[model samples]
Target: MTLPTITVDLLDSKAKQTQKRQLAKSLTKVLSETLGYPDKEITIIFKST
Candidate 1:
């Protein structure tokens, strides 16, 4: 089975962990609905520089 992977880069000065999680969750939900994929098949990765 193929899985979807999302990579998010944090370049903002006010990036928070809670926001990151919410963003990931929202992205996952949108992707799942738009792409007709399952939530378990989606992967979200967050990177901070």
Candidate 2:
């Protein structure tokens, strides 16, 4: 099966590194649990808008 890549766009241009890490971790955890996918298989990409 192909892995899933989740793209997240942040509205805040000054988002901190700590906040991004936390957001990525939380998104990965929730997505993995809800979608039954492995943590390593889920990809989270953050882009500043």
Candidate 3:
């Protein structure tokens, strides 16, 4: 089965690189644990608006 892509869009927001990475890591972990999906199978896309 194919998992859906997770896209995060920041609208007129400014965030540091480290912050983004940490957010991604936290999100991946939480999502994986809660949804029973492997970390490697999760996809996170960050977009600047």
Candidate 4:
């Protein structure tokens, strides 16, 4: 059994796109692992607003 996908809302008020992407990827990887999901299967959406 699988649960519905989750969403994270993060904003880069001062960070650059590169930095945001890096953080997003790292965060997603850790979250997936913590949530018992494969890191590679993690999905992350980064936004700056």
What shift in Å separates residue 29 of candidate 1 from its native position after superposition? 0.7
Q: Candidate 2, after superposition: displacement of residue 49 in Å?
A: 2.0
Candidate 2 ranges with C-alpha deviation above 4 Å: none
What C-alpha lDDT values do all the predictions have? 0.89, 0.91, 0.90, 0.66
Residues 1-49, candidate 4: write the lDDT tens digits: 5542445555546777897678877777777768777766666665546
Give Cα distance to truth, residue 16, candidate 3, Å.
Answer: 0.7
Model 2, residue 47: what's the lDDT?
93
RMSD of each: 1.3, 1.1, 1.0, 3.1
Candidate ranking (lDDT, best to worst): 2, 3, 1, 4
| Whole-model alpha-carbon lDDT for candidate 1 | 0.89
Better of 1 and 3 by lDDT: 3
Candidate 2 clashes between residue pairs 3 or more apart in a chain or in different chains: none
User: What is candidate 3's lDDT per residue for 1-49, written digit by digit as tens?
Assistant: 8884689999986899999999999999999989999898999999999
lDDT of 1 by residue, 1-49 (tens): 7789999887754778898889999999999999999998899998777
| Model 2 lDDT, residue 29, Cα | 96
Q: Pick the candidate with the highest TM-score.
A: 3
Maximum-lDDT candidate: 2
Instruction: Give the CA lDDT, 0 to 100, for residue 49 in model 3.
Output: 91
lDDT score, candidate 3: 0.90
Question: How far off is residue 9 in model 3, in Å?
Answer: 0.7
